[model samples]
Target: MKRLKLLVTLAKKGAIGEKVKITLRELADELGISPQSVLRLLDEMEKEGLVSKEVLGRKTYVEIDHEGLAFLESLCDAISEALYNGVIIGEVISGIGEGAYYVKQYAHLIREYLGFDPYLGTLNIRVLFPKTVFDALCGVRPVVLPGFTKDGRTFGDVKAYRIRINDIEGAIVVPSRTVHPPRIAEIIAPVYLREALNLKDGSRITLRVVKG
Candidate 1:
């Protein structure tokens, strides 16, 4: 698991150079394992394409490939969401913040100006991808909007995103902005939900309650 974690971390960061790279010997020393053992693990990962290996003269260079990246990106999200719902995020950022915008699209946010260590975990966000945003986008593409407001406004000016999200669980509607499981669905941007309801464009700003 240690070697796998190290490999994935290095690969995801593209920690390679023109000369090719191998596991850092310092890393092996710290992990209390010989470089040979690390090599064996890399060999196994290479067979799976989770790691790619190149034999150059007397050295073996290994790095993460696309498959490994997908896995880690998924991991980053799972861990982040778990933290978000588990004793981490202090207050319900009920106003517009990052989650309401892009994580739903790029699966990553790219801002570094915020004072706090920007939550670097993945959002457990899911988009039902409604007809509006999907239809309007150039490729009929689905995107997560980051600029949504907390009091049920929206991610952006165009609330036509087909992105519907659960605002309720089992039998009850979620109370706005406290803490709840990602599964419970209380804390959602109102705009995205509204679009999914096929609203009249500028109708009664009521949250479109979906049948959970």
Candidate 2:
């Protein structure tokens, strides 16, 4: 588990295909362990073909090996399957009043890729789970809404995951450049979910992944 955690940490630091210069002390600090323990874990991972390390002068560079990448991908698949087979619970929350504007901006793309014309606004939910709501979307493929330039303004790409809430079909939209935290989910559906479901702040909701 420590080796896997180390690999995940390295991957999060953008060390998948390319080398990332990191120190044992920095890694130890991040993992909350001693530098010697980190070194031992790295040695084990290296022997298992999970990572590659190189040294230059006083610098240490590390990268995830192919096997490491494969391992992470498999883990993601397993997590996704487990999440899909179950359900995630969250509480209704209010947004910063930007959902309507963003939804209107990507209306066309949402209709094209998500197969529905979303309502004017979104239903914000604060996921109460292991951590980020993204945990439920581990290996699931998302419908990518390409960014566009309009009226001298540029919009970033968005990723949409199909979901079902109380038997109502909807989607969770995640903007590439977003101010929202990982625990917050912005949902879009064909109708106003708040009115349709009679929801309010602190209302608990269940979300189920709809596999395509």
Candidate 3:
């Protein structure tokens, strides 16, 4: 399980760079493994050239190799598909009848699985992974669904979904503005709901869940 996580980390980061600078103690905590186990994993990864370590004075750092990055991305894409339920829980913010908005802070960070539409240009979803699923993946990787973009990168909204339901029972949202465009922020993935939203092949524009 611990070995699997290191591999996942490599896959997600693309490349770990020449000097991966997390302390041994931090690494252990972040990976949810023992420090001793970390040493073992690092040793194995170094042997494989999946990672390379650098020592600066008394400090040590490690980063993923190019080959390791490629390997991890493929694995992540596959795991993402099979790991979670298909049903996605969210609301379309822009469509909200009048004056609805998801708080910006909630939308931007990995607090909850909130979903907002482009209507707000940002979103937040309370992380809603089930305890069982989340627990199983405890050390598999740090939280955050695969492929979510922060850092002001925009794709062609190609992965859009035509949400069929307007179930805003507990969904909260904010409106659009110049500084903050509407977006899906708070999103929850109920297994069956996610399965139902099982995106079809080549379907673009993921459903912007938070909409007023």
Candidate 4:
């Protein structure tokens, strides 16, 4: 799994199509191993038909074979499905005009915890079975945004659950720190989710909350 992860990281960083040109030293540095170790690993991978590489003048041009890519894709699919699978159907709606301000204020923590800088506002959705889902989230660990002091007042801590809506990775933001009804949920993503997902108010979408 670590070897495969290294290959995927290389592909993302240096690959164009199926081929990537990276040095043994570079790969070793990225993987935090010695060049000799990386060469041994690559030799093993090559023997197993996971990668093919040719050394040319201190640079190694590597190619992940079709079999290797297929294997990686299958692993990715399984992991994604496992990480995101609490089915909740919801309809988009407008918020109470506080989402933008709060999101802007909390943008730094969102990026740190969620791996994306969310847009200025959130996409509010009126969820079906809101109580069941909310209660489930309450029982699980969440990505916590610690409360901070701003403008002489203290902002309360917020909790988030990893979710993917319409295949876009985001989170179900439960700010129980504030007064919010159980019927509505807010989603935050890197992009303006409604525009990115081509959605409008009244459009129904699915939220897959991550299993605890």
Q: Name the candidate that leads on lDDT.
A: 2
Worst 10 residues of 1 by lDDT: 84-93
Error of 1 at 38 (Å): 0.5
Candidate 3 yields a Cα-based lDDT of 0.43
In candidate 2, list every pair of residues with a backbone clash: none
True-structure lDDT of candidate 4: 0.78
- Ranking by lDDT, best first? 2, 4, 3, 1
Number of clashing pairs per prediction, in order:
15, 0, 71, 0
Taken over the whole model, the C-alpha lDDT of each candidate is 0.40, 0.89, 0.43, 0.78
Clashing pairs in 4: none
- Model 2: residue 83 alpha-carbon error in angstroms: 5.3
* lDDT at residue 130 of model 3 (Cα atoms): 29
Summarize candidate 4's per-residue lDDT along 1-212 as a digit string, tens digits: 66976778666865535566777787888888898998898889889887888888877888886667778889877875554346778789998889988898889999988899888989988876444456436445789988898899877888888887766888878775655677778888888987898999999988877765
Q: Judged by lDDT relative to the true structure, which candidate is superior, 1 or 2?
A: 2
